[model samples]
Target: MTAPKAWSYSALSTYVSVCTLKYFFRYVANLEPERSFSRMYFGLAIHAGLEAAYRAWKPDAPAPVGVAKKVFMDDLTIRLEDPMIEFKKGETPEGLLTEGMAVLDVWAKEARYEEIISTESEFTVPLVHPGTGEIFERGLKGWFDLVVKDPDTGEPVVVDFKTTARRFSGDKLEADLQIRVYSYAIRQLYGLDRANLRLDVLVRNKKPVFQRLEVSQDSEGDARLFELVRAAGRGVEAGVFWPNDGSIWCGGCPFTQACARWHDNPDALRSHSEK
Candidate 1:
């Protein structure tokens, strides 16, 4: 198994707890996904719209609702041209465009930040072992959706944008691995002892909803994130891969066929490990 040059939250989260075989197929074997889901592309388009709005935003001005909707339309138009997207039942490009616009409408009204420090900020930090405090060669890399100063506290707030079918529960926000990783990154990059992480969620409903959930970084969560990253990295280096069958994600996994082949002849795994 070839070691990934760098690790991202998505990579570590999937490898450590989600599905090992899926990680191997995508990262180690470098296999193209058999199908791409429409929801993934829809989220990408919405993210682009949010980024555009934030980029054009001015302090103490009306939110760029029109700019956001226009960008979402243009972005989704281009994305829809890609024929690989497998739209879910009852989902069409036209319907999604309308739904995306409605989401932006709600998001614009609630857009209030004291200062927009950065948007889509790229970060790379050394992966240090939680137990030994040993820094690994490969770094952890990710992009911050938005970074701003809190109007009330005058503290740095790291924001992540999400398009969810339902509002995230407080427990879900607290337990999210992505949030923990971002919190850890903020400590490393901004030199802050504690991180304020917020999730700006656009809920998909008949009438869309926008909600912001805040989570403070704790030592335990940060330590858990570091340890998970360390374990995932070591597992990859050791060529450890397994399938998590009988799970919800198993049905729609793009690597299902490849995983089936792997089960029949495990020796095939050797070919992927060869340098």
Candidate 2:
């Protein structure tokens, strides 16, 4: 008898086959291993920097400098064990820190007109569809980078900050599940419709791209997303864990060795890549 998995966007938006086993390894066996990606550390540093910078940003206040990066990396060093991220074996954190700082600087200038409502806001709500009766026993949990109101129209907007290797168009954002989930979740908690959406993509060695994307879904579209949550919950309950043989995501997954052991030879789990 397995316990019901707590529903979350990370578990739902990803492929069920991959996500289910990830859950199995993590919660069931408590054997999920975590890998440290320098890039992930870099991204977190940038996110923390932006969160600090934005929290101090006021429509009439002077834009502060040198504080955001300082605040973020100060704590990050301890978290990542102060490892020198070897981008090319001799690479240092100087360049990466500068780049993330550049993004905050660019945003400080560009976001003068926007009034921020909230940043790093979080929510956990019952998994239910808006304007529909479909509700699940499991709940959804998530965090928002920023929530602001349109200065001119007084409309509420949700803004997400990203540290991307390349630029992304508004079209891709319009189709992303993460943003849709946020939009839907916001409405459910706030009881407001037409909450605008924006994605601030901070690209390395390039000026930050600010994109305002639309997030509107009909009941069917809403139902589609809710179904993903339902399906994840169902799969977890039935212990329907199976290896997704053809998935591209399997390559980067941390559980490959364990996954191989379950289906392949048990002795070969130590060296998953060999076979």
- Which model scores highest in TM-score? 1
Candidates in order have lDDT scores of: 0.83, 0.65
Q: Where is the poorest 10-residue window by lDDT in model 2? A: 266-275
- Please report how far candidate 2 places residue 13 from its true position, in Å: 2.2
Q: In terms of lDDT, which candidate is strongest?
A: 1
Deviation (Å) of 218 in candidate 1: 3.4
- In candidate 2, list every pair of residues with a backbone clash: none
In model 2, the runs with Cα more than 4 Å from the true position are: 1-6, 15-19, 32-34, 82-91, 129-132, 205-220, 245-251, 264-275
Tens-digit per-residue lDDT, 89-125, candidate 2: 5445666566666776775666554677788888887
Among all windows of ten consecutive residues in candidate 1, which has the lowest summed lDDT? Answer: 218-227
Off by over 4 Å in 1: 129-132
Candidate 2 colliding pairs, count: 0
| Candidate 1, 1-275: lDDT as tens digits | 65677788888877876898899888888899887877778888899999988889888888888888888899888988887778889999999999998899899888773588899999999867667788777778899999998888777899999998787787777778888788888878877878999888999989999988898985567566666776787888778888898877786688878887887887677666665
TM-score (C-alpha) between model 2 and the true structure? 0.79
